[model samples]
Target: MALIRKIIKTSSNEHYPFSVPVIENLKELDLEQDIIIFSGENGSGKSTLLEIIALKLNLVRISLDINYSDPEFSDLKAAINAFTVEFSLKPNGFFFRSEDFISYLRYLNKTKVEAEKELKRIETEYREKSAYSKILASMPHKRTLNELDNLYQRNLEEQSHGESYLDFFKSRLRPKNLYLLDEAEVPLSFQNQLTLMVLIKNAVAEGCQFIISTHSPVLMAFPGACIYDFNQEVIKEINYEDIEAVNQLRNFLNDRDRYFKYLFD
Candidate 1:
């Protein structure tokens, strides 16, 4: 499993100053483990850094087949173009951002609606232009329409957001790739986070590398993961137990009554 050895922020003087200040001061990030977890609070630049790395590595965003561009990406692209990357190997993988998951769900619904509309049009055309309809339909292979219709019939939008998100991810993730995830715990429950942990474990076992930025104690607790704390705007490796998310959970669980008393008092 070849990893991204190093990422150094070369030139900081760019058009758009990084919204997250932590990113501007980042001199280098060393990837020493197969599973790297970036743990940080809001505005800590975890996602910002992950996006730059993912784009530099050319990782595709899962569930987004269409070329949908965001104006924010252009700025990031320009910034990442200035960074120096050292990769142990040319990696291939998908970048999963929490925001993209939301957009993907909307895309799924939109696609389903469009497919239904197309189906209706085909039906109407078949009635009016029977001979020509058969030609047009056959040109696409009768199976093409049926296959798309079948997909719409079992549309992922029918499931819960978490379930559909998992389904979409499962459908995209493949073996032997570098998966960069930013705040992946966004749409998942505690149980689903555990499920994702299992999936990541299996993927790593099968030669996949994962670099995730998250605030979930469950995700940060991934077995043998290299956890980088962004609490002070420095990406420094730390023990899992030292992670704020993990410690907060530990403190609350250690004395639930005390936590409640502190909160109420």
Candidate 2:
């Protein structure tokens, strides 16, 4: 799958004054990559921008603000609704915020139950026809279903927050789909961040694209990612080494004595 070639944000009085006129500068950004990182301080319009882009592209938008409706989301919702009506993109995409995970897990569990009912119905139909013949014919498929059920159970048993998030990702991701993740590393530790990175890389290779907003230095370090510095109101393509967060972290670790002395002094 090709990367998103362009994002065009036409001018609207939604956020700005009517007299300011319509500007398309926001839509002019070109994000064509396997993974695009959106970095900014809180309330820097990062989430809003992601919402707009996800709506425009008909990609799944997952963040902490999925349920809460606010004036900030007005433009985003309008844009998404308009795009969905105009295009034939599937509405199966979703936007999940941090707190939404619990609800999401509950929804998935309900879906698994439904799937199990379907599987049972199919099996019963086959058994009533000819027990041995239908069983023999469905042996392979039955095994697959059983495997899926086992996997689902194992996933449900994972109690670690990070593992649960990873499980959700593994189970929900589909090929050629757009996934917008906000603070996806919240539950992950440093080591798990590396594992998640590998998973993201693999997913990208499998025709999935990601737009993520995170503060994790480990995630920001993804090779060849475009870094937009909302703190500085500047956008540039840079390696992870150049990120301010990473640099500051490295500096502190490299000279703990100096930092501690300054603090004590």
Candidate 3:
């Protein structure tokens, strides 16, 4: 392994993540593939396990402005210390949580709005002042706008939510790092999810590794990626076709009217 080699739980305290059945099980997981995925339904422990791993690795969150030290994460912070992770190399990466994306988007838009308001105020207040004074007064707001523009060169808010999500991911994406993502496909449409898969494939080709926790069957279809089914009683690696999401999707497509009838009745 070029990065983390394994993860082991050294203590037996029934803490938050530890209290979860699948996470509480004693074990070590060896890293073999560059792309690892955790697949399961909600509360099946996929997202929680990924979060603990991200904490162990000390990776930055993809959606910025989150305070990890907040009281809400206190239990997870303590729980992570019980695990000992073996590393072949200190890995670099970001932990992306879908739930945080919208908040991040709002932050960006809010900053831009504030800057615009300041610039407008400066223009009105400095109308009768010397050109140099006006320029100096407006410099800070202009600089803020410039830095925001450099982020994506387009107004993210102007795009559809799905478009903005992809743009944000692309802007933050870098090579030769690991990415831990939880349900990144939430905002994407069926077609956009495939686009995201292509992006992941290209990044992996450039030495990036990913450990994603997702319910999307399209993501689970990544070729040669190692997938663990959290839906199982124990954490177990499984094939694509055998994944519950994949099977359920296939069933729905095969008998769409049948499903609608059952739901309606």
Candidate 4:
């Protein structure tokens, strides 16, 4: 059974633009697939829907501490809270907001830097006292730098942003959990998106469920993902090629010169 069977909207308030899409259409939205995607242009309310699903499922994520109380998400919070969910298991997963990634990476970098500073301080203190001092040897932070070196192998800060984001993602993802991701493709290149697609595919095979909101045609092509199109302002399942982003890219790639001529002229 799927973790979240469906979300039934209970509010009729259209006071917020973000709430309009769900209020206008979804009475009882079914989420039977393991991989569900919400795709649409920016500000078309797809990210709001992804947030609604996360709220309704009562997901526990790092983003919860920062975003749940923001005034901008107030409408989505209210709308999703009003909805009822049928669950097969108690939901467990992280909600990864791509927008929050940079701050998260910065925190990691700061943590590593502080750890290094502390280790240096400890090293100097040990040298001043005695190299064989048991007290200094027993300090928990004495070997922190070595431990970090062994654990991370490569510091996330040393890699590209896309690589760091993927590292963050892989560290948090676990099997049989329901993950809610918003605009996950933002930091990725074309090749990295393909790598991420493979990761998603493998995670799904291991009993994980994902609710992703994105405009990337690369991500939209994930095998067997139930894609909901939000362009028309009514949620409907769509094929990979039918996605507007995919269609536009296809058209642009098919004849770039012709498109340039029309665009420029």
Candidate 5:
């Protein structure tokens, strides 16, 4: 079952977020399926709506925090306040945004390195101390490093970007919750994207709900999903075969010569 049943925005504001044509025309979005996808061109309100949903639901973010009070969304604070979210069951979940993924990886690696350095310093500082006292002094740093190692077996930097990203997403999954992802396919290739799509399918089958905003045809092809296209004047549910990106990719591969000739000419 879907965690959130419906979302209603009760404000009429002439602001950047509200002024964005798609958002301006949005009435209320009813989520009837386990996966609700937001698809549109960049600069459309796809990401903006994701932000608002993140704020209203208080979904757990990876390495950054966002609220109606975020300075970047200052103009839309009041508008967000007017949002009303109805739920079948309110469950906790994680929010993943592609832009913040790298920053999160850096944070993990930096913290791990600092802990290792602290352990070394403790060893030197307590050189003259008894073994028990030295162990006591260094316990926290050792535990920190151990926990990080368990969380990510090797340094994230050592892993390919795609591999690391997929592992990170997998490590965060918990059954029976909602997940909000924005362009999560950013760091993945076609094969890795297939892996991601499989992961989503498994999660949904295990009773998790997903709201993903992405452009990847692989992701948009998720079976039984409610795909919302933002390219129109108003956001509307769209058929998978009719999605702009899907047909464009299909056309490009089927007639690359025509495209190349057109471009060269």
Candidate 6:
């Protein structure tokens, strides 16, 4: 598959004229990897960087902020508005922050409204044609239609937060596009994070590119991923075993009794 080849950033320092400037250092980074992981502590500008890249690439950006209608949403909306005004880019992304799940459920409910409208339309047509044909012939496909409606309702009922997150990805992501995901592991467990990694690999193989900001050790462990550590202020190629979280986890697991004895004893 054809890769991004390069992402040149005009300013690595935030002090540049633009809040986030254009890409300038394309020669320094590799663009052929299946996944790119951004690791950082809170307030490390990881999300900001991802947003800037999303604007530049005209890709859909998904993050935990998509579900909320609070001050964060307003701030993000302002940034998106500013970015769109500054750059001629179309709105192709969906924001699914934690609070945004309610909005998604509302959207799914619209399918029920649409299905009802279709049922009404079909009933009217059937009644209108009943006079010209056998009543049996104009009985209409109500059973199948009702079954579909029930199926959609069941889906809405079964939409756990994780499932909803996955649903959004499955429905909104298209081939040959860019995806900026911030802490996508928020709704996924360790096992699900691994599943998501596989999906990301498959997507990358199919010509989709992703820039993800996350703290999940499982996600950070994606094979052949490029990791940037905001805490260290360095972009280095490292395996998951080298990540602080993984090392911490390993240390605790290796000497659980010793570590627990300090508190318990």
**Which one wins on lDDT?**
5
TM-score (C-alpha, index-matched) for candidate 5:
0.93
Better of 2 and 4 by lDDT: 4
Per-residue lDDT of 1-265 in model 4, one digit per residue for the tens? 2578887767566556334664467777788888888888887777776666666667765552475576767755665656777777777887788888778768766767887677777677777676667355545664665665665546778889888777767766687888888999989999988988888888888888888999888888888889988888678888998888898999999999999999899
Tens-place lDDT digits, model 2, residues 194-230? 8889888887787777778888888887886777655
Task: Give lDDT tens digits, candidate 5, residues 116-186.
Answer: 89888988999999999999988998888888778765667789888998888887778988888999889
lDDT by residue (tens digit), candidate 1, 1-265: 5467888877776354365567767788788578999888887878778878877888786546534376666678778877877986788888887777767778756755666676667777677677766567645444554654454434566787677767666666677888888888898999998988888888888888888999898888888888888878567889987777787888889989998887899
The candidate that wins on TM-score is 5
Residues 1-265, model 6: lDDT tens digits: 3235544443233332123222212224444554688776766656665655565555543322344466544454444423322222232444333444556566656655665676666667677575545344424444545654554434743667676666556665667665667888987777767767777788777767676788888888777777876554444556677778778878999999988998799
What range of 10 consecutive residues in model 3 has the weakest lDDT sum?
1-10
User: Model 3 misses residue 84 by how many Å?
Assistant: 2.5
How much does each candidate deviate from the true structure in C-alpha RMSD?
A: 3.3, 6.6, 2.4, 3.2, 2.0, 7.0
User: What stretches of model 3 exceed 4 Å from their correct place?
Assistant: 64-72, 125-137
- Which 10 residues in a row give candidate 1 its minimum summed lDDT? 145-154
Give me the displacement of residue 65 in model 6, in angstroms.
Answer: 7.7
Q: Ranking by TM-score, best first?
A: 5, 3, 1, 4, 2, 6
lDDT of 2 at 161: 73
Alpha carbon lDDT at 107, candidate 5: 83
Each model's lDDT: 0.76, 0.63, 0.84, 0.76, 0.85, 0.58
lDDT of 3 by residue, 131-166 (tens): 999999999999999999998957888898789888
Candidate 3 residue 254 C-alpha distance from true site, Å = 1.8
State, as a TM-score between 0 and 1, how close model 6 is to the true structure. Answer: 0.63
Superposed model 1: Cα runs more than 4 Å off: 14-19, 62-73, 128-132, 135-154
Model 5 CA deviation exceeding 4 Å by range = 65-71
